[model samples]
Target: MSFETALKTAQDDIQATLTDLLVAFDGPVGDAMRYATGGGKRLRGFLVLETSALLDVPRERALRAAAAIEAVHAYSLIHDDLPCMDDDNLRRGQPTVHRKWNEATAVLAGDALQSAAFEWLAAPLTHPDASVRAELVLTLARDAGATGMVWGQALDMAAESAEDPLTLEQITELQRLKTGRLLEWPCRAGAILGQADPVHLLRYAADIGLAFQIADDLLDVEGEAATVGKAVGKDADAGKATFVSLMGADAARDRAHALVKSAQDVLLPFGTRAATLAAVARYVVTRDK
Candidate 1:
């Protein structure tokens, strides 16, 4: 199937699973849940499914994990747009969770969504392997928590000072932790679920994670807010560190190309099974949104 078709299928599955889980909650929790989960590219979830497919893991078996990753992603976006953070009023072309609802509701909603991700992952899988489930939950937590994405956020916030202008290496490192970790985790989790070789899984995760970040940087430079569904030029306006900021736009584009090539190279061993993922890496940099 085409990457777009595959992405849509994965997104539909994630939305269905998230809806079921959200319905169990009540009040502002439910509203926040709906708002946060409503619209997204579902990139993280797509990574899970694509990686699982490459490793021969059944799509049905990987659905819960995909949904869990998306839950965490949505929660992060909600919190990231809060007044204390980026303070953006728009996301996916709509008012942010905090703006749509009260601040407390948005905060609680983000917290609830984060907690729900772990709960979903920890729930029983059909394989009945307690060890596997535990590992999955742990992997997601480490990637989403302070040691990973959160660390990246802290670094990003800290780098906002004019005197603290980031080097190219520092910008890359920040993206790896902040934006790339979550993308990497889903692929790694899918590989683990499929019982693939650990070494190969790690390599795939690293490549895709880096590729995802490069694409994001490229998008920030060239994309439109109407299509991208997030504020553009905010990076420059905020004096934030970014690949585009460190390298000129042309250099950043070239770097993104290299990352995509590296990502595809790592997946060569998986042959045609990894075609979708390879395409996705290219699409990531090439896409306007």
Candidate 2:
């Protein structure tokens, strides 16, 4: 199947589980959580399914992990859109959680979603092997906590208030932690479920993850808010440093292209089995949003 078609198919699978899981909860928090997680490209979750497919992982375990990732992603976005953070008013072409509901609702929903993610990961149904489930939980905790996504976010928030702008190297390190880590996890999920060596997919993930951030930086510079489905140009307005800011647009674009090329190269060992992932890497750099 074509990349877009395959991606959509994956989205359908992930979203159904995501919706079911959230709806099982009760109260306004559950309502808010469902709303917050309702829409997006589901790219991270898609990575899990695609990687699972490539590795021949069982569908049941893969789908659970995919849903788990989507929950975490939605929580991150809800928190990221808070007034104390990016203060985004829109997401996925709809009102951000904080704007649509309230800050308290958003915060509670995000917190609950995060808790649910761990619960899902810890569930025995995700994998028959207890060790595998434990590993997923432990690794996710590391990547999503102070050591990874949160670390990057703290750096970003600090940069906003600092007297001096962050250097290019600093920005790169920040993005790697904030965005790249979670993206990498979905790829690793494939190997985790299939019980295969993950070295190559991990490398492929690193390159594409960086490319993904670079592309986001580019979108901030070149895309329309309507098209991007969120407020665009905020980075520039806030005087934040990004790939485009550090390298110049031309250089940044070239860098993203080069990263995508290397990403494809890393998957050579998997050959055609890696085609979907390779397409995802290219799409990361090329997507308008």
Candidate 3:
């Protein structure tokens, strides 16, 4: 199937599973869950499924992993949109979790979503090795937690008052830690689930992860808030380290294209099996939002 078709199918499965899971809870907890997961594009989940498919893992297995990743991503978004963080009033073209509900509810909801992600991963699946599942859990936690995304956020905030302007290298390092690590985890976890070679998988994961961030930086410059579903130009306004801030807009676009090409090159070893993922890399660079 085409990447778009596969992405939509995986997204539908994730939404359905999320809905089923959320149905068991009621009141504020349920409301927070729905608010967080109800309307995003499901990019991380789509990556999990697509990467798994490329490595020939079963659809059912991919779906389970995708659901878990989506939960973590939703939780992150909830926290990121808090008044203390991005303070975003809008998300996915709707009120942010904090805006829709009370701040306390939003915080608790984010906590719940984070917990639920590991719970989903721990559940029984076709992968019989409990150890492997545990490792996947650990990998995701590290990537999404203090050592990775969270660290990146802290650094980003620090960079705001930095006396020296951020260089391209510094920007790349920050993006890798903050945004790229989470994107990389999905593909690496899928590789583990599919029992692929660790070396090849890590290489592919690193390339695509960096590519994803470059695309994100490019989008921030050119994308609209209405289309992107988040605050636009926040990077420049905040003086955060960004490719576009270091390089001109056209140069940043060129860099994004180069990264996408590099990602596709890394996937070439998988040949035809990697086509969808390769397409996704291109799509990441070219997408308007």
lDDT of 2 by residue, 124-235 (tens): 8999899999988888888889999999999988998999999989998999999998999998888888898889889988999999999999999999999999989889
Model 2 RMSD vs true structure:
0.9
Off by over 4 Å in 3: none
Candidate 2 residue pairs in clash (backbone atoms < 3 Å): none
Ranking by TM-score: 2, 1, 3
Which tens-of-lDDT digit does each residue in 1-289 have in candidate 1? 8888887888898888778778889998788888888868888888888888877777776888888888899899888999998899999889999998978888899899898888888888623677778888888899999999999999988887548689888887988899888988888888788877656656766766776676677677778999988888887777777777777788877877887888888889888888998887887777777
Writing each residue's lDDT as its tens digit, candidate 3 over 142-183 gives 999889989988887777778987888887888888888878
lDDT of each: 0.82, 0.90, 0.80
Poorest stretch of ten by lDDT in candidate 3: 197-206
TM-score of each: 0.95, 0.98, 0.94
Best of the candidates, lDDT:
2
Q: How many backbone clashes does candidate 3 have?
A: 0
TM-score of 2: 0.98
Error of 1 at 178 (Å): 0.2
